[model samples]
Target: MIHWRVSLSWILVWSCSLLVGIAILCFGYFDNMLSHFQQLEPSKIEHVTQAAAKQETLPRLHSSKTGLALESQAQKEKVPNKATLTYKDFPSPVQGKILRGIGNCYLAAIESYMFHPGEDFLEPEGTVIRATHRGKVIFAGHDPLLGEKVVLDCSQGWIVTYGCLENIWVKTGENVEKQEMLGQVGFNPGAEGINDQPQLHYEVRHGNTIQNIETGGSNL
Candidate 1:
């Protein structure tokens, strides 16, 4: 009986060890298979690269009044990260129908899904664009996609960006009062839509996150 009990204990121990060994082997095999399948080359990210390369280029926009191309450079705005600023409402930036709102939506013009972080308005060429809030101009220049762009830093923690325009009136470091004319909708050769209609793209941001222009209050 003693010998039988010892044999039974040994058999139980051996069985548990065998089961544990099998489990470890199975886990290792599955892990190796997953890693082998997940090891992808950079070409696997072809979708993003293809989309970027397929982006359409803009033709040189000739100023209607001067018939000459506008020349401007891009600027890097200095934001006060340490300052605690209050949020406020912005007046209408332009008079036009809203073509696009702030969110992810499909744009037929670009033939792709765009996560639009701002609002787009439709207006005729040369429509006046106004300052949403009284703020200092931090960036006023040309962008590859935004065209003639202007950025304003409202002391109350809000930063506004107006794009897809021409005939910019504000310059960097200039203080502009609310409702002041900053620019006008023009050729917008870098416009988002291929419809050939003049559109204004406006963005309001607090910190690094963009706020909805149509909404009354800030979500930041």
Candidate 2:
């Protein structure tokens, strides 16, 4: 009986060792896979390169007077609530390099879960951001993710937005002219995985759809 008990004890110890070995193997496999996924190649980022190419030939925008005239006509004609925005209805809000272009971004071989809704202009901190069209300030305040944000209502469902601002120059309900200073660009705290780079986020909305400001207009 003593010999039998010794044999049983040895079997139990071997079982525990085998289980621990298996756990270590599983952990190592997962760790390696995670690391591989985290180190995405820069060449895999197609959108960034494509946008960089497009920026070199971005079209010149019409003067501020054209934007004002378009706004006036839209208001006079009583355009529908879901007015379709033309390229001439807006202008570039900033003059800077496109940091992160509109759409998805790739990092560490991982694709972003959400599509970027606007263009990011890499400008210096405190660089002025202007309104792209004649409109009324609808929102001008701090946002949890965007920091300082400003939204302009251009009437007839057309709207323009500026984000990542350091200072806002206009107030809600105030009318702003095209090319008018709205605010200054600010540094992002990497809340959305972006580093502390100074940039202005610009978006043009016609009702619900967000327009591509690069192809849609200059500077964006």
Candidate 3:
């Protein structure tokens, strides 16, 4: 029994020593980690922070440049073109009453629905047709339905068309002044059967868009 008591005493002392050694090892490891963190230089930390800040601001810089470019383009669009005409520059092709106006319209003579793309002026055959605006005669040719047609490219982006003409005085590529005689009114027997009367079909266009003769042509 004395021998067992002695052995128990030794075991207890060994366990206590082992626990104390483990505690010392844990404390030493923590101290080393703390010292490593303390060794970081202030300048190095500042550099890292500045790099992170630059990364955050890079996208904002690009957005600002894009906004500036868009604003410049908008300003350019607001300014009018020097070659373009104004409201006062436009004039009528003939002095006559309006027979058929622009847009979808019904004609009694044709007895069918049609989309009239221009204004028809009631005029007698052989009435002198004049230029509506100062322009270059881009086309003076024959149309299948409009008979003899004349197209003028005026200042800016405006174009004028004179249809159902009996004759064309000006040739293609000829430059003409406003009110210059272009042709005489005629009947488009192929398409225009309205009342069998001679009339002038006038059309104005910008780009690919057809414009109204009453408002759009006047308010060039």
Candidate 4:
């Protein structure tokens, strides 16, 4: 009876060992499956991140292209306007003119000396001065040396200045037509009371650069 009980206890011990080995094998299989799933999850996340990065990059490239296209369109739309002044039929404002060919002859020297950009027409005092072209008055003011000055900005990059005037009749930014009276020529400040000869010191500028006005005037 003692030998039979000992054999039953050995059989129960063997059965428990077999169950524990099967449980260990099953646990190892489940752990391998979890590791493979984790590796696949990282690959999926990398693919999603690449797709999102492509989406963001494409929009930025498209926006840059659109901006360049808009800038090109703006460049194409720009156009230069017509010239307001013509080389014919413009009359001299002052009568009994003593400064004939003053713009043609003496302007080059005056420009060199004072770095002045325009011509000087020495006429009698109170000579009526006219606008050279149809334009807007940009400035109408007085300087101590220049006396009364009138500046007109015409079309096609042309600007005309009338200086050494006794009085100014126009205001700044006023639209002025061609041959309109700007002001009367006055005495030079240095020759005030010594000599009363009225003269109009005129200047023509092309986009802030002074040019010879004789090239544009009609010979009377």
- Per-prediction RMSD in angstroms? 27.5, 33.0, 14.8, 13.0
lDDT of 1 by residue, 151-197 (tens): 99997668888988899998999999989999988776543653667
List runs of model 2 lying over 4 Å from the truth.
1-85, 106-112, 217-220
Model 3 clash number? 2
Ranking of predictions according to TM-score: 3, 2, 1, 4
Task: Give per-residue CA lDDT, model 4, range 1-220, as digits (tens).
Answer: 9999999999999999999999999999999998886778777979988999999999999999999999998887885655455433233344444343333332231333233344556777777788867889989998654568898888777677788887788999899998888888788654211234567777666664555545763222
Give the winner by lDDT: 3
What local lDDT does model 4 show for residue 219?
A: 28
Candidate 4 stretches with Cα past 4 Å from truth are 1-113, 191-196, 215-220
For each of the candidates, give the backbone clash count: 0, 2, 2, 2
**Global lDDT scores for all candidate models:** 0.77, 0.77, 0.82, 0.69
TM-score of model 1 vs. true structure: 0.55
Rate residue 18 of model 4 by lDDT: 100
State TM-scores per candidate: 0.55, 0.55, 0.56, 0.48
Give Cα distance to truth, residue 17, candidate 3, Å: 99
Comparing 2 with 3 on TM-score, the higher-scoring candidate is: 3
lDDT value, candidate 4, whole model? 0.69
